[model samples]
Target: MDFPCIDRLEMRQRDLMAGPEPTYEKVVTGYELFHDSTPFVCDHGGVLPQMDVAYESWGRLNADRSNAILIHTGLSGSSHARSHAKNSRPGWWEKFIGPGLAIDTDRFFVVCTNVIGGCYGSTGPWSVNPATGQRYATTFPLLTVNDMVRAQFRLLDHLGIHKLHASVGASMGGMQSLCAAALHPERVGRLVTISACARSHPYSIALRFAQRQALMADPNFRRGFYYDGVQPHVGMKLARAVATVTYRSGPEWELRFGRRRRAPDQPPALCPDFLIETYLDHQSERFCLQYDANSLLYVSKAMDMFDISQSVTRRLAAQREHAAADLGHELATTAAACANVSVCMNIEDQPASTTGHSQAETEDEIAQDLIAGVRNAKQPTLVLGVQSDILFPVKQQREIAEILRRAGNERVTYYELDAMYGHDTFLIDVVNVGAAIKGHLENTT
Candidate 1:
């Protein structure tokens, strides 16, 4: 009895064993775009006929295509994670990247890509829609952390990276990193998420809502259609000022700016009298025009709407639906692969097999859902939380570690930092944060 499926499986094993290992050349060290004409379906109902992802990379991919690390950016950061030959300017994470740094570009092929809805080179509110030949502006589709990761996946496929050695991020970047590994456990080997939560809390959502309100209040905003006119500078400034307040601790601010007047000699005015006020003014002034207002609204909302439990439900349901249509084929394939026991063993690190169980089998418990979301992420995980960060409290980080542990991820490492820098501790307190990251990256076990 000659079984065709078993014969094909044996031939696949022979091809794998006989061939020389494939190798990929290192990516160019500069800004690049991965363009896909295929319609990108959004988590929401919106769709894009064509899209582009702007990215930058450093170091070399090994011959076996391992040792690749993908770094996600904070809410406003771009793809420039580190300085390269093409771009000499220092990046947002300049201190943490490069040779002998926390990320160690010398050992890992590090890459960072601006989120699709960002104001950077990637397609967003600023990009012109091919269908209408006009800018998408506020008309762009609603974005989610999952949508952002899915878009990044397109770029990864283009670069021929089948899997990532690690995915790292802080703040909103942390949210993206967590979502990436949860949604595609097979694609990411290790995970590091700092100052992030499994879901957006009420306080954080309120803060982001206030930022949106400020931006929308400007007459020039014109309901997010201010692209061709004088920008809503006042609104944007106020919004940034509000966001800046949440980025650091009040205790740190007291030490940095205190009650000192901007100018003691000058009589008090209605505006920017205190040093702290002036500091906020400087921060907002520099930011108001740099980023697109609509992008700020979109990305922040995405962060607000993110809930890992909901995401897991959606993913599992989709997988169940897909499996229902091809149960016979799946059984045959599983049988054929079982015939080649060694071949199956060689790929043991692959994603866990999805049972043909109905989606209803998964309970609606939120805690259970959170656990389920990351259940298959058997990688070494690092979760960092800053005690002084009011926006994303340390408890959120604790929850992440607890959930991962409950999910049976034994390699999870949790850190509670007491840095005075608050939510921005990851950016300023590099000595502590760097050491934590360096240790995690080097841990091969």
Candidate 2:
């Protein structure tokens, strides 16, 4: 009668421990990882350690190991990108990756990692900092997209994956995918950089700044170290609310929600009125519940600081990968390059390479150019984008395609469409999206 494995006891425990976070993260079937170094030392003195990574796998890796497809998540997303075949709740990327879906299990072996600084079971401000024997909170060092990619590299190594068919993602995830291909092209055969850019744009920076201010403004926000029970929930919500606006487009919001009020006849207050409003509210609520506030702030900044042309140039100086390399190299080597990229924003009144909320601006173009050195990458690259998406627009996807084409990349393909839901199309319209992805990867010999 006192057996601890009793359903009643376990159910109660689940309710008590689970609020909004992934309570079963420790043993989720598809979600797994290699938890090793958090302090993945970077070029800067800022040491990025103290991390736990959550990951999910789809399909089976081929004996050759080159069939593994890597997926990177955008801001606030974890490794639970799709639902298991029979699972009730649709996985985050169920549309694009599933048994018969786009990134089909029948064909490609897929791997997705919860980036460092992520709160979804991955080490973040919430995880106890080994150095301090307490949650790092604000005490955790600043992180970058490179750190995330590096961590993923180790995970790939742990999994015995020698190469990937393609690496893809949207928004920040898109940024990571790009960085991965750029830095480790040899490790990945095909590169799919969806709604992202070679560098961060000013509009993106402005949007991120608005979101970050919401968190720091909260009195509970303790710089980057508020792990002690007190969390900036309101700030995080506000940030999400703001970001929700950007993740889609004006036309999309109008078409989908279109000012529809909620709960039939109840006046609008703290509750949502329209179906889209309700949808955003649900996502934000779940996000605030599961995702850590500080981790969001830090990761957002990491995306902002993600340019690497200098390092890239040095890496690929011996041989050019393709025109993607030649153009980027020419740009980085030109005076106009600074103006075209690393824009001079007056808001922070700092050099583009030193702006807060502007990881893209601060990005060393050299680091980004490293993609040029890779020779004979075999993965098929597929870049998908929503027409109305403002966050990472179809234009951005085109830029990525151009880069691949310029690289003399024969395995690259691009698709841009009218997913009226805007940036969320990839997440929402998975059937169509996934089907497209599946078709392309499958059709190829």
User: Number of the top candidate by TM-score?
Assistant: 1
Put down candidate 1 lDDT per residue, 1-445, tens digits, no spaces. Answer: 3354345435644653455321111121357888987656555534555788889998888887788999998888889888878888888888999899999988999999989888677888778877557777777766778888889988989989999999999999999899888878899989999999987878999999999999999877887787666677678888999999999999999999889998899777666779998899889977876788888988998888777774454864464345334333333342332233221221113234321233555543666777887787778999999999999999888988888899999999999998999999998887999999999998877
Writing each residue's lDDT as its tens digit, candidate 2 over 69-91 gives 88999888878777764334556
Tell me how many clashing residue pairs each candidate has.
0, 49
| lDDT score, candidate 1, position 100 | 93
Rate residue 444 of model 1 by lDDT: 76
Candidate 1 overall Cα lDDT vs. reference?
0.79
For all candidates in order, the CA lDDT equals: 0.79, 0.65
Model 1 scores worst on lDDT over the 10 consecutive residues at: 20-29
Which portions of model 2 show Cα errors greater than 4 Å? 1-30, 37-39, 48-51, 85-89, 263-283, 308-380, 443-445
- Which RMSD does model 2 reach against the true structure? 11.2
C-alpha lDDT (0 to 100) for residue 209 of candidate 1: 96
